[model samples]
Target: MITSAVRQALRTRGDEPAVLCLIGDLGPDRAELAALRLRGNDRRVDLDAHGMGRPVTVEGIGGEGEPSSVGLVVIAADGLTDLRRAVTVTTQLPPTAHLLVVVRHVPAHLGPLVPAPPTIDEWNDLHELRVRRFGNRGWACELCFPGGMSVAEALAAVVHGPRGRRRGPGVGVLGGLSGTQAALWRPGDVAARGVTATGPVEIDRVTPVSDLVLRLDDGGGLPFWEDVEVPAVDRLATDATVAPEVRSPEARLRVYGTDPVSRVAPVDERFVNPIGFTKKTKGPLGELVEVEGRVVVRDETCVRIRPTPDGTVTENDLERVRHLRGVRVGWPEHGDTATVRIVAALAAGGVPLIGDPAPMWAAGLGAPLAELIAGGAEDVLLDPLRREEHSIRLRRAALRTHGVRTRWRSLAAEAGLPVPPETRVSVVLCTRRPELVGFALAQIARQRHVRFEAVLALHGFSADLPEVDAAVAEFRATGIPLVVHEAEGEKVFGAVMNDAVDRASGTVIAKWDDDDWYGPEHLADLMLARAYSGADVVGISQNFTYLEELDLTVWRGYRSEVPSPAIVGSTILADRVVIEDVGGFRPRPRAIDSQFLLAVTRAGCRVYRTHGFGYLLRRAGGGHTWNVDLGYFLRNHTEQWIGWRPSVLLEGVPAPFGAQADRHIDHPGEHVERL
Candidate 1:
């Protein structure tokens, strides 16, 4: 396969640096033909053939520690006999290799002794099988069949004596049919896959320039019509009507007579296939033995007939049988030609099939194959651990099967831990644009059902601006007790959050952004979820037309069907103790918030999601964390914090004092000293 692909690729890349390898016994004719095909196509197809000229045997494939170096492998069905060897070759191929396989359907064996529409007694013994060879190969196989000659010739139209000197058209029935009358179109007309004149009354054949065509209605109770192409003739059987009804069980049939045809009678609905074969018993051999069997052919439509004294298996007592179950038995079209050819070439070294064939087989083949494959196995081997999918699914299952159970609030309540009824809720916000501070404070003041203290952390600037001071003064005048914390140090988001948590005297702290507009019922939802989970942290996911349009602080609670926490970021944590215990977040710019959530979650805290619009994240151009590649940072950060790796923390964001931020990686001694 690799050799064929390489040869083909070389031919297509004319004059390019190309190489080819042949393993095992190389057929003289095949090799010569391939060489000729490649050479004639272009100079790039230059055969720089390599590998042991002596046939590379199947055993040599993926030999010991050896790996075949090939860009792409094409396994044509012509050379293969042993499908297992082909699968093995593909399975062992390197990660970068590409593979292609071609498939061809073979005819099933129904013994010559028991002809095709087998006798009731022979139906069970003579099985008509459709072998889906390589039934388990995961490789995509393209099935191709040869198209017939020209359209008219393929349809098999009758021709008259001569074009110029035509014999009188054979007299035949001219039957017409039409669909139900409607404003425009109706599907009342019948079409057929293939049709034949049923009861023939000879008609004169006239040679026309092309195939004759007709569109007419054969008057019947139901409005019906047909578009037909049939050889015209005289002396047609006009006594028979044109049957314009074609069902899978019966074909649209027409009879020709000496006069214009009368209405055509419908064929029995039980008769499948326009063309059929049936034989009636002639001797007492048919009466003594009851013929009771079902024809089981793959691909073709078949009928099952059950036999009884009254319901002796007859042509009329059968129904279409779709799928059949049996061990397929047959050889390729050109026996051992393509199969032997494909197998011989691929056996030398076939591509290692990607993904497990068992599950894929079960999926494609359904219950029968799935049960067969898993008859005696521990479990199906899914995507290997090398794939992110395997690990992700496992993690998700773990979280769902045994979810986080926190002891903080429960233990506190059980141990009669003191409850501060007057506990305040602290709100924190950060913004580069100070002008938006007023709106943020107004929303905070509007929380009628909640009591909370708000803090605005403005970005540190070398020189104080009048606008900043005015925005601070404006927010303070809203009658909402506000603290304008001077963010003078280097901008580290985690550090800023820690500062707000430390300064506020609140039992629960909620995080927020400055520029985001809040939903009126946002605070109420958080309190409700926190009360329900009885946990320190609450989480939720945001629903928005665009991610940037979402309020980062609030989110509609997670859907019940989610089975897991949705938004890990927009969660509320009780007090500063858990936050302080979690080491107060790494001061690095990227993934600080996500990293904090991971720590809280790992610490056995319950996170609940609220439904509806939570909070929106106001996107802006520059921030120490946002300036660099945020996606790259978050992906690594998640892998490190969530997947566990401290070294990931050391790979700090490219920011001022990014190195110095490590000093704050560990919690303040004073905070931990009390814990």
Candidate 2:
């Protein structure tokens, strides 16, 4: 029987599917078996295809009193003719409906079209379906599942398999990976096409339990509807730390991050507060790096403050000092009382102040500006709003920096291996927005790490556009290997992206949105995280999506829920191998990222999140193919704070804010419903 967890996961309403029908000239036993296959969930109107000729039509089934309200169509295939008839009938289905095909055998001629299961077609005497695939869209049926008698019993067999069945005496693959996932999956091969099976094995597991490769449920097992690959972020984390390492007593911490100052214009009112101006606050820059020598290495975040020759604290410079990732203070040569009180203000605000700036001196903190005055002159820190908003933000960022620094130090000390594996990346850019594409292409060029290539898929008019041609020309001029794939059609986001992946030669495939801000070190950091974590996909742990029109920062869930994770986000970098196994992205245009993430996870591939890459996601308002509209975002997402970031003003795309996206205005507290 399925365990409680599996049951909860596969929860069903048990209502009759809207329209269930019998297709082709089938025996009575086939229909009964189909109903029995559904068992507890059986509620179908056996659509009698009485008068429907060779190529069955939806109209023919409805005329015979079958409920024409189609939601699902179930067909039992007895032979080659039945299969072809079902394939044809499916074309008439509403785009949203699903079709279930129960096939005893597939026509050998059609074998090439299917990524048919290894040698399953060779088994002539089998009584049930062994593998499944769609002609082009969505799921079709396999009536019978792997290694079980009937459909229901096959589903119940999922959680009953024995785990930790390893050849070695110690523990199994699950034992190597310690977590809830390990407990749920067994290390040994559970299915007939086991990991060790000869012939075609799609992808090998890095570690047995971590692999968790799921086959397409052809026949049975708790709704084995799709093949899945769940990424093991936790496994990546543990493996990174525990892997064997060589002695490197003096490994220096490398500084890798992109500053937001160049992108941000000081003119925006949001950056200019009543007391001071603001610079973007970066996260987790305070990781420990091994520097040679054992001279009392205390902290990674400490930064020594540098001042002007005159040594007087400026009004705007206070925010600069606050933005620094450390707390240890080192006075300038021409130090004055003003700089002292700025430290005093920071200390009074509960920001940690340390006695020594050992680590700080090494990190180089120099210069000052007018952002937040370090001068205790006007006592601007006394302003209640300033104190509530600015001070809290400063304190929180400093604390997080301190915490990350400490954690890294501990990890570095415990790590067995000196380094992790690095995978080459191929960034897939599929878009109709030429300008944004150019901008994204430029940003890709800015990445510090050069172990990558850009595979761009331009659809519709973009393929032939002159401006796009020039941009492509310019990118190739830089000696970067750029490959462009073009198709003439309306947008299908998933399909286009999948096409790009098919052309990519990199070890990791990075999915990038047309419009988003990524720092120069973005690719480097993602690769570094991938090496250190061994995660299938590495992305920034946390990200914020800003609405350009509303000037509001939107979030769907807790801003802090994902901390130091091992997966990628919408702009993701996934293992090219895993992408192949999961069949790349889905076919639809809308909600494609969501669909991709779900299918990959279901296929037992791991998605892990890493520290931030100075990532900022943007929503340009309505006309967006996906769900990030002003109304949808405001209604669905929780507002983190009233904040805005620099605009992605780049070349190939249109006036990004105008024709590309729609905007909604709030007129002095206008009701949302009215808008």
What are the lDDT scores of the predictions, listed in order?
0.31, 0.38
Residue lDDT tens for model 1, 1-675:
324434444454423222222221222423643554433212211111110011222222235764332323333322211121122222212221222333221112100111112124422332222212332221122111121011111111111100011111111222211121110010001111111112121233753221221122222221221213333221111112223352222222342222111111111111111011111111111001112321121222322322221111111121111111111112222221111111111111110011122322112122322233223121212212112112122222221111111111221233334333434678877655444454455555555446677777775642145555554555556566677677756767777777766777776787775444345445654654454233446654442211231211111212321213446353343445667768876776567767777787777654444432334433333443434333422331111111111111112111111223223222212211110
Model 2: residues with Cα > 4 Å off, grouped in runs: 1-422, 462-464, 553-569, 611-613, 628-675
**What TM-score against the true fold does each predicted structure earn?**
0.29, 0.38
Error of 2 at 644 (Å): 4.2
lDDT (tens digit, per residue) of candidate 2 on 1-675: 112211221233123232244433333545454534333333333322321111223332345665443333444443322333233233223221333344343322122112122234433333453233433321233322222122112211211111101111111121111211121112111221222111122344552332222121111111221323432111111111112352122221211122211111011111111122222234222211222311111234553223221121222233334443334343433322223323433432233233333222222111121112232222323332222233333332222222222222222233321222334678888777655555566667656544788898887755456556666766777777889998667758778888888898887788776667665556765554443233455566333566777666654432211212323345577677777777877788777766667776777554545433246566775556565436755665533556553212111121212221222222212211110
Error of 1 at 550 (Å): 14
How far does residue 152 in candidate 1 sit from its true spot (Å)? Answer: 91
